[model samples]
Target: MPAFAIAAEDPATPDIAALIGQHLAEMHACSPACKVHAMPAARLAQTDVTFYAARVDGALAAVGALKALDATAGEIKSMRAADEWRGTGAGPAILAHILREARARGYRWVGLETGRHPVFGPAQRLYAAHGFRECAPFAGYVSDDFSLCMGLPLA
Candidate 1:
């Protein structure tokens, strides 16, 4: 089996597409109609967005992306871990890898939007542990009761 690795690889791969679709579906199911902010695979394929897949033993375990909101800021988008890999380190590993990528790209800040539903508690905690604090609406986001926005400022 190949060692676990993350790369800006093919988001068109079936496994990656299925995982991202599940993520968007769950978001739409949990949040109100206007608050469903998950991006589609086609949007993530744009030049400003860098999509990554975490692979374990050659199987796709998780997927995420960093979308340049502007020159100094980037947003974490479409972050989802496959069901079988939830409890594994795949989520955090992918998150950490993306943050490093954001920093390398000269972003002074990183932000994300996640559902406020109870089901998202673990995800909220994961971002909090990595220094992303609850913050106001950013970029094109508007304040909504069902959404929680978080941001971390880099040195």
Candidate 2:
């Protein structure tokens, strides 16, 4: 497979929307709670925020977003990699790229909420490997059995 490139762009872009659709589909396919807990795709696509995607051979392989929560903090949202691309380092690559962009934009800390179920083990491992540690919920999210909160300092 070709090397992947992560690009920072508007999620409103058509290509980005397609990638988001694929991401949401994969997440929902893996776990129904993804759709239950996730913000609607249409709403996410319309948000004005920093969005990133990993592209391989000009096709989107993974996508994520960093929404500014405050001057010093940002929230990781809509993180997903295509099923075929999972376990290929694409998710971590996309995450690292998102963090770099977050730091460049002046965020001191990045936070994220992901599913806590056994089905999400790989995702949890990916976040851990990238230096994200468990943390209390940030933003307006409530603690829930189906969710886990994680954070990392921007270097």
Candidate 3:
């Protein structure tokens, strides 16, 4: 098996649902309630978003989505790595996969929104390691104390 493998998956899969639920709950818990921007399973299933589930050694490792923002860019939403898989690089693997997908689809950039809480420090580090640098809000999000955005240009 490869060091990291990813595949397209149904956003509504029961396993994916549980991961996303936990992600949303954690986001809401650590930040102002209205600042949580996690996408629900239903919304993740929309045509504009391509969702993925990743596994390692046959165990569910994580889930994420690449949401099309326009012809030239996409937003990564709902990134969640199962607690058991954190620090094991599963989430970053999914992020690398999302970037590959963006490149394949001719997107010049990929961006994401995460929390500003201390609890999110690791997440910030992960994105930074992948070349996702902080940027102004790109989609519907805005500048706020609790919300931060990052973008990586593919080309």
Candidate 4:
């Protein structure tokens, strides 16, 4: 397995931009237009969000972000593993990094919204493996048929 190095980066950079564009495209394709909530590169670069990129041998492997929702909570956003790196450790590595960062920042909980469609099964399992449990809508989100929200409380 290739080793992944996860680090904070600007999502608007050339390579990262292309990856995020692909991520957005896939999200839109698999979910209804109204249910697709993947953020564009510009939004991922917002002051309240910290974006990260995972690389293997200096090549981009995946991307993920943590957005501050409040003084004690955060939301995971824009998690996408490059097609070539899927099934590798890229996804989990980047996820662990985000969780670690959340803890270091003293967050009480981290939540994420993902599609409830079968296409998102793997992602749902990934989050579950990391101790995320099904939860109600958070951070202004409302209960919806197309969205599944999960949360992991930091102890």
For each candidate, give its TM-score against the true structure: 0.95, 0.82, 0.95, 0.97
Ten contiguous residues with the weakest lDDT in model 4: 138-147
- Residue-level lDDT for 7 in candidate 3: 93
Alpha carbon deviation, residue 71, candidate 1 (Å) = 1.3
RMSD of each: 1.7, 2.7, 1.5, 0.9
The residue pairs found clashing in candidate 2 are none
- lDDT against the true structure, each candidate: 0.88, 0.76, 0.88, 0.93
Per-residue accuracy of model 2 over 1-155 as CA lDDT, tens digit each: 45888877667677777667665665677555533455544566555566777888877778887778888888888888877787787888888888887888898899888886687798889999989999987776655776788999886
Candidate 3, residues 1-155, lDDT tens digits: the string is 23656898887888888888888888888988789889999999999999998997667898889999999999999888899888888888898898889999999988999988998999899999988898999788886898999989899
How would you encode candidate 1's per-residue C-alpha lDDT over 1-34 as one tens digit per residue? 2345999976778888888888888987888878
RMSD of 4: 0.9
Candidate 3, position 50, lDDT: 96
lDDT, residue 105, candidate 2:
82
lDDT against true structure, model 4: 0.93
